[model samples]
Target: MEKRKEILNELEELSPILFKIKAEGTDKNIVVPNGYFDSVENQFLDRRMQVENEIDIDIPTDYFDNIESAVFAKIKEREIEEESKTPKRKIINISRGRERVRLSFLPLLTKIAIAATLFFFFIKGTDYFKSNQSIEEIDYLASISKTEALNYIAANTHEFETEQLVGIEFTEEIKNVEEITSEELNSYLYENINELNEEDFSEIF
Candidate 1:
């Protein structure tokens, strides 16, 4: 009892607010919002995965077992001392500082402006470089040989309007027909026997 009273007297000397709070007992139960722990449990679990190694803190084995009794005893000890004391109203005054705070990002803003100007200059310079390129530079498309262009067009005939594109110079007239000998006709018939049906064979014969 003497030790408890001494502890309360020491606590009152240290913090009167704590002393007053001890006299008026507060609710022990802590209220949490509905589903608060449920919602945050997954987040904590995810954060746990990011940590590669387990962090170990050295704790006394008997710390939790004795902590509740220790806290209760201290509060009880304060209460006895607080019952005899009368409460005083505390007045608090809050006011702003006299000097205005200077903007922190002025230097950053200056650097950004400089960067933006340089970026535009760089873009404009690039465009000027492209526009003022040497006129004497080799023209690859103009250097293309006529034969190569013609071959390219022929190879990719479907890609171009080939029939409409071709003119008199590119077209060739049919040569005079040459008569086939009897043996040649027989050879052609033998080769194409399956291809020609009775109607075609009749027309040919």
Candidate 2:
């Protein structure tokens, strides 16, 4: 410690002499007050020679040997503690910021399945109506004539009343047949054809 203070004092006192060495003519003359100039000049020359010759540059082994390892350990521990105290920044991955989510999509698939089921049922209903329509004139043999068959069916199938049955009257296609009721005609039509069972009569027209 004493040696460090002595070196500091010497550096402070000799700073001006070293600064003068860089002046224009100081290399030849070195102007200063009488006795102080010579003393400062000798110190400057001695320091300059020591630097030029590389004297006292090598570190002594005793410097490391005599040093307190505890002091160095404490200093290193303080440095590590200071580093630990500093706040760490969180890192964000910009490449993954816009990634799309991976989802199961089961609900969407269920809705599509339901809609397809409804559509299938609607198509089935349309086909059923088209195929089972009884009013269409597909069975031409059953109808005698267009206008006559309509008039005959309409007049015979209307409501009528007599002493025995209280319903519509009907006549047989055969000659001299007993009078029949509309309920019997309905039963006959229902038994003969499958489409007439749904009330879509096709025999007349």
Candidate 3:
């Protein structure tokens, strides 16, 4: 308690004005020195005037009014530019794809057509060569024997005419006669007696 009293005494000694104000009643009017508030009011007015004079920044009247419209116009122009670029990019891509497809397929189709044409010509040429071959050449190539051919001709002889069988140099004259023995001549005479003429009988006699 004594230490608390000593601290209070020290605070009272340090702030006598505070103690005096506390002793004065709240109802008492506080007094000011002569022209004290007037000096303070003059200082404030001077400071305000100096600040207003130092600040010389000015703005055009229409700047704020058109700022929103200018910003929106810029945004709209950017959108239109992007819209225009989109179709151009798509067109370029599609054209490139079509060109690639044509380049890839054209050569393949051409090669297939050429191959088909070559095959057709090869087959036709083979058939033409076979058709132009001679019958003798065909028979030789087929390994047919002469006897087989003669037998086939003989079997179909009715189809051939007498003129076609005989040569252009054939003659009706006899070239020679072979001598016959008496026994053979006698047998022939006896066997052909009915076919004999008077001239043949005269010669035989």
Please tell me which predicted candidate would have the highest TM-score against the true structure: 3
The C-alpha stretches of model 3 lying farther than 4 A from their native spots are 1-21, 25-34, 60-205
TM-score for all predictions?
0.17, 0.14, 0.18
92-161 per-residue lDDT for model 1 (tens digits): 1212344221212322222222333333334453343244434221122243333433344334435533
Pick the winner on TM-score between candidates 1 and 2: 1
Collision pairs in model 3: none
Ordered from best to worst lDDT, the candidate numbers read: 1, 3, 2
Please give, for residues 1-205, the per-residue lDDT of candidate 3 as tens digits.
Answer: 5697686577689998776665575445767889898799888999999997786456446755764454334434534553455332111111232232111222222222232323333445334333433333113212233343323323443543332222111111101011222343345447656755665455334
Lowest lDDT sum, 10 consecutive residues, model 2, at 163-172
Clashes per candidate (backbone, < 3 Å): 0, 0, 0
Quote the positional error of residue 54 for candidate 2 in Å: 6.5
Local distance difference test, per candidate? 0.40, 0.36, 0.39
Candidate 2 on 79-104: residue-level lDDT in tens? 45534663443222212234422212
Shift in Å, residue 188, candidate 2: 93
Q: After TM-score superposition, what is the CA distance of residue 94 in candidate 2 from its true location, in Å?
A: 7.6
Lowest lDDT 10-mer window, candidate 3? Answer: 168-177
TM-score: model 2 vs. ground truth: 0.14
- Which of candidates 2 and 3 is the stronger one according to lDDT? 3
